[model samples]
Target chain A: MDSHSHPAPTADVATVAARWSKKAVVVAGVGAVLAVVGGLSAAKDGGFGKQFGFSYLQAFMFFLSLCLGGLFLTVVHHLFDAAWSVPVRRLNEHLACLAPVMFVLFIPILILAKQIYPWMQIADPASDAALHAKSPLFTPGGWYGVSILLFVLWTFVSFQLRRNSLNQDKDGAAIHTQNMRVHAAYGIFIFALGLTFAAILWMKGLEHQWFSTMYGVYYFAGSVWTTLATLYVISLALKKAGPLALVMQRNQFHDIAKLFYAFTVFYAYIHFSQYFIIWNGGMPEETFYYVQREQGSWWGIGMLIVFGHFLIPFLAFARIDAKLNIAVAIPVCVWAWMMHYCDMSFNVMPILRPKGFELTITDLGCWLFIGGVVAIAWLRSLASHPVYPLKDPRLGEALGIHFHDEGDAGHAPAKASK
Target chain B: MADSNIDYTVKLGLLAEYATPAELMQAAEKFREAGYRRWDVYSPFPIHGMDDAMGLGNSKVGWFTFCCGASGYTLGMIMIWWMNAHDYAIGVGGKPLFSPIFSFPVAYECTILLGAFGSLGGMFILNKLPRHYNPLFKVERFSRATHDGFFLFVETSDPKYSDIETRKLLESTGTRQIEEVRD
Candidate 1:
């Protein structure tokens, strides 16, 4: 029997690190130039400056949500002892490292909360009226503090676990496995709590008075959808760059593609269900959110997502050929990323523009700035280690398996050795 | 070793080949009833409950899927709360921050998303899919079983298996051809 062992060459790691660093520098430079241009333009229009700041806050929160979601996926994979994700788990873990960066990035939102959130402008008595009339559930300070604590805790735990796993590679100790299992068990609990608080602070609070029990799940669906799409793009880029060329195969890509499809559908279902239920109930306050989203420019974006996010991708990925074919999968992955941005934009813009609003230089700038920072953080993490988990026990198992057969019968049956 | 047409025939050793799907299923049931543990059934198409007929326990996949679905729901709810209630606290149309009606879509989506993930991930883990190489694949004739044949093999590792006795037992069961499986 073959030992099924293989090592990732050091030259491969260096090449990957160098390529990612170059890409990071280029993206950062472009984003910096755009931010200055957008800031100057906003300065020319006084009211637009305020909108720029608010949009920046919205973008920051969206990025933070993506990091938190990545953390949740990593911990869940650990808890389940998942093998299929072995090829890409490192990328997800590295993305989680951005949580600390997000913590700092979120400061902009915290400073300008009053300007963006209406609840900040109303005094205690007026707030009390709003709260009383609304549902005595308003607690801005408590909500803020809990969100900070959750981000801190998740960042701390995820970094520690990932660090330990990488260290295990050098030490080759059985104790690392034991430690990981323990971390995984507790990590899942924190993930649940942290993600819940994250959704409340980010999306649900967009409309302080408008409450949705399903808001967290809705945000979660978007999070997973975006994160999975992001992972697919990153993995594809890495493969093209040639460092992870050997480790990632068509089978791994197939797995990631499947996840992207599943979550895309999941996100659409939640989006529609929220609308359907609110429209059916006919409540003025709850239904108004949808009314804003379904009309004007926002309406057009929603329609785009309906067909672009769900319908288009659903048809494209329905067949086994498309899911496994990079030619087809890459475009769908890019579309998923675009739809995620549109979805987040639709959620954020409608809250600020009661009378409806137009897209500004700031909206695009905010996305670029935060996206630039996220790209930088991800690159820095990737540079710090090999693109693949060089010492993971399952690396060999993943390499040896072939998930699909050449013909239309799909998965082939296992053969018995003579 | 001598030329008794059956002796030199190479005791394929307890290998039982079935001409029809029903016969294969019946042999599986009998082996299961006889308390045989280390045996497997092969067919041209998936034989439903062959695992159970062989007395295998229910798969652990359900537990994994349930956990994933439950967590997905919980995660969805929390995400909505964090975004709407905690972070910005903006009031859109005077709706409460924790409205169940609004949050249901996200929660439901998470459940389905996680459930599907659990099913796919669980199937891979339980059945050990994507395995390109297995000891069983070394059997030349075994390759055709997946194409258009039915077979049942009681591994020599089984406690009840013996060269002579097992062969006689398989002969009694009306197998026309038998083949030895070596590890």
Candidate 2:
């Protein structure tokens, strides 16, 4: 029988679902406790609480970027008809589900908007003249509602498409493909709008007077970078679980790694462009952002990302042979995750401590809390479906077991299995 | 050699068909082990490691990318230098004439553009693409190659080829339904 015509392997859906559900409940419980404890601790210690508020806002922004990145990946994969991503595409889709969870997480930002954002307090006539001068350009209520609405719309659309895809797999419906394509096209438009408002709300609004057109693209580049990294780590974990093992292979891993590498370069380009432009322009307002970031304790973190995010990883994964090696790939993935956290800190912390101080426990706690919440939400989504789309038309082709090689001695090619 | 060519054209001998992917791959490996070099396998999709099985070398696209990327970088530097430093000399932002930082974005774009073009051109030159026709398409059964068939062609032009000997080698390697081409 030809590869495409072969029946899918039978698997116990109930068993997979139960395992993931249990894991999700455990993670959610832990995240809830941590968030409560972290929140209470911040309130008790006024100095530390202020830092906690900022870190909590940063974590929300980071997770927001991660989910948005997944959304972009899903769109790009469908646009290009990429077959290699089929194995990991489900994981990315599930991660995209975190957008709603992040929307809820953003509640803390709204509560602390006055403390975290200078724009929110501009109504006080006694506030600093410089802050009042920037108030005309900044509107907190408008930004908050817009940001939340955009997230809701993006989540609703993404979930719809993801649902259709899963349903298509079970019933072998071809129309769903067409439905998804149409949805994705519209989804891309919403994504662009949502992403712009998100950048304005989360990052730009931090310093309300500060403005940069490149900020939107900068945020996007970072989002995609972290998303690709998250997808790689999750795919590796899934392969280790042994259910989707047959679908995952070295070639697939290599492709994802290449994408990660490409986006790191893209991120660096956007970052340098923003920095050089502002420095050359010499606008005091514009230069203030960089001056704060380029000096003090944060400068080292910035330099580390410049190298760790792009240079080090670029050199390490330049060769095809290295991209194919899991041992090498794993470190690059881990480093990417670290670089993302550093990048987020660079974007947020400057507003809080313009002079740049040492790392604090609040920063670490907030990241852990956000990480736990995101992990739990993502695991819950995975519990609802097969890890790999078993009935996907491209799965066989992705597995490299198509019709042409039938009856050949190379049927189970060594490389194919890898 | 001329006599063998005539024999091959007249009829294919010891023809048998494979019904499974595993069998076809096994036959391919057998051919590899037997040190056969003048054969080609046609598949509906790209199979991993099939190149090694067929003894193909690494692709030359990388060399193309490197050369084109270097040229692109050089061109970007020269273009910006001529436009800003030499031609107009209009300084708006008090920036230096030869700003590597300013030139970086343009240089990066050029690198990607040239690299992409180089890969495309190299692929075209290497694969001899855009040809309207090929002699291989003349074979009736070969059409299935783009669909469901995996085929190995032991060309008559190869130095080691003889009608009788090649047929024996193919049969021994478990290649089913071997065919001959007339050029």
Question: Per-residue lDDT tens digits of candidate 2, residues A109-156?
Answer: 777777777667666733656555544435565666676788788888
Model 1: runs farther than 4 Å from truth? A1-5, A43-49, A125-140, A354-357, A401-418, B1-183
Interface RMSD of 1: 12.5
lDDT by residue (tens digit), candidate 1, A1-418: 0123445444665667667667767766776576557767766554544566667866776676678667867777778777667778778888887888888777767776666666656677353554555433346676567768877888888887788778766755657656766887898778776776676666666677676777777877878877887787778878778766666766677777788788878888887777777765788878777887877678888788788878898778866557867788788877877777777777777876655545566766677778877877887777767676666666545553322222211111111000
Location of the lowest summed lDDT over 10 successive residues in candidate 1 chain A: A409-418
Model 2 interface DockQ: 0.25
TM-score, one value per model: 0.67, 0.77
* Residue A238 lDDT (model 2): 68
Tens digit of per-residue lDDT, candidate 1, span B93-116: 666777766777778789889988
RMSD of each: 13.5, 6.1
Tens-place lDDT per residue, model 2, B1-183, is: 567655434332223235444555566676666776666667777766666555566688877887898788889888888998899786866778778778877987898899889989988988888898866777788787788877776665566667777778778766557666654
User: Clash number for every model?
Assistant: 58, 23
lDDT of 1 at A286: 87
lDDT by candidate, in order shown:
0.71, 0.73
